[model samples]
Target: MTYDLLIIGGGINGCAIAREAALHGLKVLLVERDDLAAHTSSASTKLIHGGLRYLEFYDFKLVAEALRERERLVKAAPHIIWPMRFVLPHGNAVRPWWMVRLGLYLYDFLGGKMTLARSRGLRSSDAAYTAPLKGGHKGFVYSDAFVDDARLTVLNAMDAAANGADVLVGIAVESARREDGVWRATLSDWRTVEARAIVNAAGPWVHEMLGSLGVNAASNVRLVKGSHIVVPKLYEGDHAYILQQPDRRIVFAIPYQGGTEIGTTDVPVERPEDAQIDDGEIAYLCEAANRHFTKQIAPGDVTSTWSGVRPLYDDGASEAKEVTRDYVLELDTNGPALLSIFGGKITTARHLAEEALGKLAAPLGFRAHPVTRARVFPGGAITDFPTFLTQVRQTWPFLGEKRAERMARAYGSMLAEMLAGVQSEADLGSDLGGGLTELEARWLHDREWARSPDDALMRRSKVGLHLTPAEHDRFSQHWAALFG
Candidate 1:
């Protein structure tokens, strides 16, 4: 089919751009080789904030843009995105206490007007902040956000589909070229289509896609692999910790799936499939955790791990950590319109989309305004989460407190539709094990494009993390029985 825009990739950037373009009245078709956010988008440390460490490098513009977007995104999807506190202990080994305090001050200032609290210095003896730490070192408490990154991407794609854009997963744009004032593309399944423009938002495959399109830009991408390990719950608090490493790197310990998630060792890689955690990375993450945590952990203590290849814009930085986290949009208009995106984080995907559309819309003779900037996601209607959660529990007491809270956060205002006409547990169909009911699974499959068990278990919802081995098998059997 012919369209206004053909987007390649289903990561956060591609999905967000599709949503933005669809909102702007563009007939858009977005194709993904795999599921949405099956790569770098799902592999983030899952924080939506002004990068505190980025301030150390004096990247003020990036920090400011990210902070503003952070505020807007939380408002847009309070169900999946909300304010989270970060406790950064002052250890003078890497950065001096004064430097961190000064950075936090600038961070607070850069955030401009915000709904979250401002950063503050905490006394070393504050039990609430330092209860689980081995050392009573003073620290700073600051505001950022935690996001269901995969769900955020899915929601954006969902909204795009609702707004009249075509989103196809498990499909690939195998080849494309500009001709006759339009761009023609060949899909993996032998389908052909034409569009006024084509966008390359392929995360790790951006560079590769450009080669097939036969246009070279001045900039290239540097592949950096980041890995994280999930272990038993480290401490009992909603707040996460920012541990400064002796090598001038920082590691975060975030709470996830009834466990603590320690992450992200940046190592340069040659290929996208290099997205596998090495023993060295595992040991490094474990050691990083052992350094500050009162509970010591080893390799065996790790429950699971994940790795993603960050296709960062090549700035020629020698160190992986020093590479820019900012995104670059390259527009090639020699024949038809072509735009390629590089090096973006989940926090600023929407902002990146806005910028991408601004670059492409003018050249393609399209007229549209930025309506998504003020708009919230389909399920993001409530102003406060706790109060909305209480309302959810009250309405669906049969789901119980934990199930109600989980469904509320995952579906938000959409939960009502998901549970429409359900009066009792039996109405939800069978409890397919794992917090998934046959009805809920059907809703996800029909509405959210959950084609496989992993799509339902992992990306669309993290119910997979909480499932037992037998429950996982049961989920797969039920999925086959229903949709096969």
Candidate 2:
């Protein structure tokens, strides 16, 4: 069958573009080689933030746009996206208070601030903000949002499919070529789909897709690998910390899945597939976290670690952190026409989708309306998150308060659908360890296109980080027997 567009890579960009196009009454197909968001999208710091440090590099416009997008996403997905207060622990080596205050002022006003709170100062003696820090530290609090990046991608694909787009996971695009007036793309799983246009939103594999299409465009992407480590919760409350290293790099110690997530070293990666957390990178993250927190963290304290390659645009920046996070679109409209995307952040993925659709409209003969701004994602159709939680509690009174809260945050209003016929805790099916019920696993496999146990445990749900090796192996055996 022929589609108006075939989007490669089921990451955030591809899913966003597919959703936009599908909502515009166009036939669309999205293909992902692995599970959606198995790579960079899931491995991010998981913040819908306007990089506060970007201001040091004079990335004002990028920060403003990201801030605006962050507000929109929080409003649209109240379940997964919520406001986060970041505490910038002051040190002698880091940028001074006045300069940091100026940057925060611009960040507050630049995005035409709405919904997000403005920056505030916390005194050294304030109990709410200063209890977890070491001596010789002041604090500044600023606004941003946190997100379940993997779930966000999955929900986007789910929204696209609900809007009549064909969402295919575990399908690799083996080759693509211009045939007559359309692009004849052969898929590894489904070999017979044609499209009027193709989008190379392959994240880190973007250049690889372009090369496979025989288009030797200029090298535009710089693969910088960033890694994160999850440790036991170090501080109280929802507020997180931003620590500055002696090397001028910064690390985030954010509250993650009931634990403290400290991360991200920017090291240039030569190969995308080979990106993994090495010993030195782990030491770097641990040391950075140890700098500000009173409790020191070692490699043994790390519960889990993940790595992702940022597909940043190469703008001759001397340092990887200085690379621009702004996206660039390359439209090849000569024959069948293909649009290639480079360098975008999770905060700006929706905007990038709108821009990409606008570029592909004329070529595909469809004018996509701006539905993303007001449209709700799969479970975000509800009005308020707290109200949705109350409703879930009423529907499944058997679930404990903590598990109910977790389910609402992860699946939103869809928790009812997930727990449809489940009456008692036993009716939810066998426990897959790590508090992951069998009903949730079935929902993932049947509806969310989760093929493997890793997809269920790792990307679809982060319970893998908490599961024991024996429990994981037992669950995997059951999952393979049922779904494989």
Candidate 2 lDDT (Cα, 0 to 1): 0.86
lDDT of 2 at 187: 89
Q: What are the TM-scores, per candidate, against the unseen true structure?
A: 0.98, 0.97
lDDT of 2 at 23: 86
Residue clash pairs of candidate 1: none
Please give, for residues 386-435, the per-residue lDDT of candidate 1 as tens digits: 99999988888999878888899999999989888999988999887776
lDDT of 2 by residue, 416-440 (tens): 6787777888998877777677788
User: Whole-model lDDT, candidate 1?
Assistant: 0.90
RMSD of 1: 1.2
Cα displacement (Å) at residue 293, model 2: 1.1
TM-score of predicted structure 1: 0.98
Q: Record all residue pairs in model 2 with backbone atoms less than 3 Å apart, i.e. clashing.
A: none
